[model samples]
Target: MDKPKAVTAAAHKLARLICSMLTQGEAYTDQGQVCCEERYRQCVLNKLNKRAQQLGMTLVPAAPAAQAG
Candidate 1:
């Protein structure tokens, strides 16, 4: 939960992933920031939607605003 602990946990996970790739003779492919951010956004949305359903509510997307000339 705290910064140090979160960093350590993430480092451990990355180490394990790298080890796995090395053993499997696989190259690491970077998904890039945009892909990672989209995945995280979708994950958060899924959690929010689930909570809303539990509270007898629903989540809706806002309408796109019109472009100003």
Candidate 2:
């Protein structure tokens, strides 16, 4: 019943986070992209995971990359 609503809420939050990150290009290194620390990743994931849990949902884990021969 409320699943769709929950998903929508979480999606909006996640989208905003992504847009914010993308717009932070000026903050990135002049030579390349931003050098994020492990803590930053953990922080973002943790926050979104918590939000999802509150909404009775979970973020899907990314599939592993294929290996070369």
- Structural similarity to truth (TM-score) of each candidate: 0.77, 0.40
Clashes per candidate (backbone, < 3 Å) = 0, 0
When summed lDDT is taken over every stretch of 10 residues in candidate 1, the lowest stretch is 22-31
Winning model by lDDT:
1
In model 1, the number of clashes is 0
lDDT of candidate 1 over 13-53, digit per residue (tens): 99998998989999988889999999999999999999999
Over the stretch 1-69, how does candidate 2's per-residue lDDT look in tens digits? Answer: 499999999999878877877887534333433435666788999999999999999899999999998
How many Å off is the CA of 26 in candidate 2? 35
As for candidate 2, its clashing pairs are none
Off by over 4 Å in 2: 1-36, 67-69
